[model samples]
Target: MATKNNVVAFQYPRLTKENYDKWSLIMKTVLGAQGFWENVEKGYTEHDVAVMLNQSQKEASQNERKKDKNALMVIHQGLDDDMFKKVANATSSKQAWDTLQKFFEGVSRVKKVRLQNLRGEFKKLEMLDKKSISDYFGRVLNIVNQMKRLGESMQDCRVVEKILHSVNSDFNHVVVVIEELNKDLESMTIDELSGSLQAHEQ
Candidate 1:
């Protein structure tokens, strides 16, 4: 276990394209533990003192302001120079978080277009005659995984079915046997089918 001092001094993981999900989750957890996540989620609203606040209300407002600043500084510390510049002018922690998200995730329009293109590529994929089974599976899985990462609702059975139809004619006999034996496509896993085909290849 880390000592109290070590835990307090812990550095957040840097954000990268590949690590966005993990990095954001850890950052949210850390900020929540520190009592600063509210600033990022709901934002800090400035109090107009035209109407006098009661003593307790004043204290609460001061605490909120402190939390917001702390949250902003922690976010800044975790960013590299380029990312830092993007959020430098943000007036609140929520604004900073939004800026970073937009920078990393791109606009919804772009994601939608990319998702459509990925779907097209997935539909058109075929196992080339010269490609090894592993290589062909890798190609198919690359597009499938990318689609999932981008928030597509791709099911495992859909992938399995695609593989059944996309393999080279060399595996036609095994494919037919597997399809005829397994009436329910969803009952067979990708690994089991791959292993059976590999054994036949050997």
Candidate 2:
């Protein structure tokens, strides 16, 4: 068993002289036992490969656009909602970015503390791998088809069709952003997308 010390001296039956002596000897036999941080530092620096990996991980983490991902996901997920009701409605891009960053910061903090408790809930979910662009486009096509059907039913079908066309254009713009992100991901040193997914969870 391990214990964290908060005081120089404290009464403890568990620290009886005999057990204390044995524990002290045992601890000394352990490598780099001067302090817990010494052990932690040693562990993180043990091998050259490990050191390089850690450096890369840190660099990747430094460039993470976690907050950006969260905002994009938020906007995409909120597409069906009235835009005027969202935080982005009244704010400039900079202001909206700040707000979204704050929101995700809190979200990330909450997740950090409880991830262990929640990890199991995701263990049983099946992952869907990317099949084909056409398969991906199917959902988008479905929406287009639905809009076309709705446009036909309206008395002002032309007006409704125009609205659908505008929506399709917007979808195209979003697709461009998605494609840019995907391409940027390939050359990027680290998986900031994963950070963004973490933000999504947030």
Candidate 3:
């Protein structure tokens, strides 16, 4: 645990074509720490700007709007000329943040490498012999989650099927029963599969 006094402050990394994956995380942390992330996450729409707010609501909106401008200023300062041009038309922090994310995330080299590595790990993942059902599930889910975080569009059914197909021979009966329950296991959630297997384990 880092004590407040011992913690060293980090400078937010400037966004570049190659560094968006890592920069985005740091930017989110900086914006969150400054209490400006809410506006960046949920910007006002055109309808919101057109509507009349009551006195209390107006005051609250004003405060939030100030936070938005502050967040935008930080983002603007963090960006280089080329990146700034990309978001020049954005009117709100959310718009700018989203524009940056959409433009860079798909093209990030680091993200691609990490995705490849995660995919390789997921492909080789299997429940080791003598590992408890929960332990094995934890390992499988860990790799799946990491892959998901790297933008893998993994569905619940795929995870269910992966778990069902990969467990040890000790679960041969349970696997067959689960497969029979749903030939495709289309609706089975990860938790649901874990529960059924754990019940059998007991």
Candidate 4:
């Protein structure tokens, strides 16, 4: 820990007077220590600040783009937990496919937002699940497949995560219904056959 007074004071035991002078000269040539405080005091104008902000925004956008692209690569490699979960818990084969579709659409919209930002297009962002589950899922699949073809990063889409459990429940219900239906049909057929046999005997 350095004391406040010692913060600006630095000394070297190994440095000779001549070596210190030479180091100073080299530092002056390599570093902008010469005008350091003087230039800083001059400061920047509001316009200059704005320009800097714009440039920073651009840099941030570029970085985001690169990150998104890399993320897309990871997505392309395989299905993530969210996607797998959605597929596994699908109420029906159709629902599972629909879930995939919506997820991809969300990803595309996110990419589009990034691109729009980069292009300086300032538009209000709409919520992803602005539509009904069925419609949204359809749209989502459309977007997902499109992005998938283009190659983008994908992750566990929390969008449908909440509904996954419900979908699973529905699937189980369907299974139960089918089983019940089969049992009921079998019982009815047996009863029908017995009644007809008794009637023939009478």
Per-residue CA lDDT of model 1 for 1-202, tens digit only, reads: 2358556557777876556668789899989999899889999998997979999999999999999999998888778887788999998999999988887677555778999999999999999997888888889889999999878998778998999999999999999998998889898888887887788777
Better of 1 and 2 by TM-score: 1
Best prediction by TM-score: 1
| lDDT, candidate 4, 127-195, per-residue tens | 243343354344444444454444444232321221222232324454354345545443333234233
lDDT of 4: 0.38
lDDT of 2 by residue, 14-118 (tens): 212124334334433331232332222222221344455566776654333343333333333322343223444522323343344455556556645555333
- Quote each prediction's TM-score: 0.56, 0.18, 0.51, 0.21
lDDT of 3 by residue, 87-195 (tens): 9998889999999887775676678899899888877778899889999989988888888876899999888878887888989998888888877688788999999
Root-mean-square deviation of every model: 6.0, 28.1, 14.1, 26.1
Worst lDDT run of 10 residues, candidate 1, spans 1-10
**After superposition, which runs of candidate 3 have C-alpha atoms over 4 Å from their true positions?**
1-107
Clashes of 2: 0
* Better structure of 2 and 3 per TM-score: 3
Where is model 4 more than 4 Å wrong at Cα? 1-82, 121-202
The better candidate by TM-score, 2 or 4, is 4
lDDT of each: 0.87, 0.35, 0.84, 0.38
